[model samples]
Target: MAAARRRNSHVQRQRACADSLAEFVERSPSSFHAAAAVADHLASAGFARVEERDEWPAEPGDYVLLRDGAVVAWRIPEEIDDTAPFAIVGAHTDSPGFRLKPSPDRVAHGWRQLAVEVYGGPLLNSWLDRELRLAGRVSLTDGSTRLVQTGAIARIPQLAVHLDRQVNSEGLKLDPQLHTAPVTGPENGPDARSIIAAAAGVEAEDLVAWDLALADTQAPAFLGSDETMLAAGRLDNLVSVHAAMRAIVDTVPSGVIPVIAAFDHEEVGSGTRSGAAGPLLEQVIDRIQDARAVSPSHRARALGASWCVSSDVGHSIHPNYPERHDDGARPIAGGGPILKVNANQRYASDARGAALWAGVCSNAGVTTQPFVSRNSIPCGSTIGPITATRLGVSTVDVGIPILSMHSAREVCAIADAHALERALAVFLAGGWPEHA
Candidate 1:
């Protein structure tokens, strides 16, 4: 009876995690919005905001720091000596999409459309004929900014089947410069600034500039015969961000300090002020050390003992394209979280980091899979190697297996998201044995 009760409890927790992910994706339509939502969550969980310009307090409590589209939150253990290491969970908040150009509002040949630049490597074909909405941060003339989302305000219509009869034999070819523009209306359509102003509850004249992107209008939903799958946009990294946030917020800290670092601009190259390539994470670590008045030697020792789990989505074996994956290391949709390894250092996982993550998963009663890209195919990267190289901390790359990555929409098993959260919570709670 006790074992049965424990099983039921686990099921309940999994259900909660899955439901939370759906809500999080729905609320975060863009990278700026995602960061804001994470900050709100941390604040509600009793994490105080710490401005970078101010000195950090040395008290043991929860705290968070924010850059434009990035966020980092941590909890100080009640007892603070100079020996504790940092346990960090890192994830990106940005995804591939079309960003509006400087002169976005254009009318040509009686059709009013918005010009856009492809922000990252998106599946351009997947965006054709999809209803889209605008969402992002709008900078006002008064030097203030507000988040806005005009739901289902535009669309990219495909050419008729009769007009493109050879489309079946020859797949559709899209030109990012020409065919990807989204239509809003006829020649005399409503102005884009007016629409943004109305949504933001500000005057149209006050809208000086904006950082806007077109997002899918379809709400995320459960798929599969038994409703065990998730279909949504931005799942490539948002899934990781959500899991990390929950783990950091819920886990009780041990001797090690737990941190959540959700960065932006990762899809492009992570080169912005709010990206992993910037100095935000390092500055925060330095501030923490200064607040505690730790000596330089002790600080170096603490950093050497620190570990980071870089959370991002991994590719799942496609039933139709099985040859694309390594036969021995392919991951499945519902197989639980995956540990990504690459000899070329595309990923930062080494044998020691892999063993540490495996132990965390084992302690959480979760199974894990390994992923290595096939020899012929080139592999993509995450923040793992960048963070490790920049901070000199040991790092591992891990995430839930996903399909249709970088598409306007993607797929993953709902159960796998829950499993990843459970394991991440264990890691953040410092369940791993301390290094001698």
Candidate 2:
């Protein structure tokens, strides 16, 4: 009976994680919304807000910082010293999609369309014929901003099969300049900005400028025979964001400080002010050290002792295209979390880091898999290497294995969400023997 109850409890936890992830993605349509949602979650968990312009406090407590489209939240133990190391989980809040331009009013042949630029590397063809919604922050003439979401307001229709008879054999080829624009309405219909203004509860004339993106209107759903898989948009990085947030919220405090660094602009090489390559994480860490009045030498030592888990999604093996993956290291969808390693340094996971992560998973009673891109195909990079190089800290790259990454929608095992969260919670709880 006890064994059965334990198994049932595990299943319940997994279901809870999956349900929470679905709600999180539904609430976060753009990076700005994602950051805002994260901030709200932290606030509900009793984390106090800290503004960049204000002086920080030395007393240990839960605090959060928010940038334009980024958020950093940390927990300081009541009894912390200069030698205390930070246990950081790094994730990105942004995903690949289309961003609306400043002057988006365009009419082609009686059809009103919105001018948009590709924000990151996306599977352009996947966006064709999908209903799209606009969501983001809109700046008003009064210097105030409001969030907006116009549901199912636009669509990018694909060329009919009759027009492109050989499309199936030739494969769909799209030109960003010509084929990627989404039609919003007829020439005589309402202007795009007006629609956005209405959704934001403001007048069109009161809108000074706006930052917006096109997002999928389809709601996330569970798939597979047993409904064991989740299909959703923006799963690549948002999954990591949600997992890291849950870990921090659920884990009890220990000697080490647990931090979540969810940055924006990672989809475009992370070069912006709110991105991982920028000064956000470094600035926050410096301020923490300053607030605690740690000596320079002690700060350096603490940093050297710190470790980061760079959480991002990796590719799961596709049965139809088995050759695309490494023969020895293809991860399956239903498997537990994956440890991504690239000898070329695309990922920062070295032998030591890998071992550390493996130990953490073991302690959590969660299985793990390995992922390495085929040598013939070049691997992609993540925030792991960037954080390690910039902060001089040891880092490991880890994530839930996913399929259809960078597409209008993506897929992953529902169980893996709980697995990744459990492992991260263990790490945050100081499961690492060496660190302990």
TM-score for each of the candidates: 0.97, 0.98
Q: How many backbone clashes does candidate 2 have?
A: 0
> What clash count goes with each model?
0, 0
Query: How does model 2 score by TM-score?
Result: 0.98
The models' CA-based lDDT, in order, is 0.90, 0.92
For residue 127, give model 1's deviation from the true position in Å: 1.3
Displacement of the residue 51 alpha carbon in candidate 2, Å = 0.8
Q: Which digits, one per residue and each the tens of the lDDT, describe model 1 over residues 310-405?
A: 999999999999999998998999999999999999999999998998999998889999999999997999999999989999999999999999
Candidate 2: residue 317 lDDT (0-100): 96
What lDDT tens digits, residue by residue, belong to model 2 across residues 156-184? 99999999999999898899989999998
Q: Which stretches of model 2 miss by more than 4 angstroms?
A: none
Give the best candidate by TM-score. Answer: 2
| Candidate 1 residue runs with Cα over 4 Å from true position | 1-8, 434-436
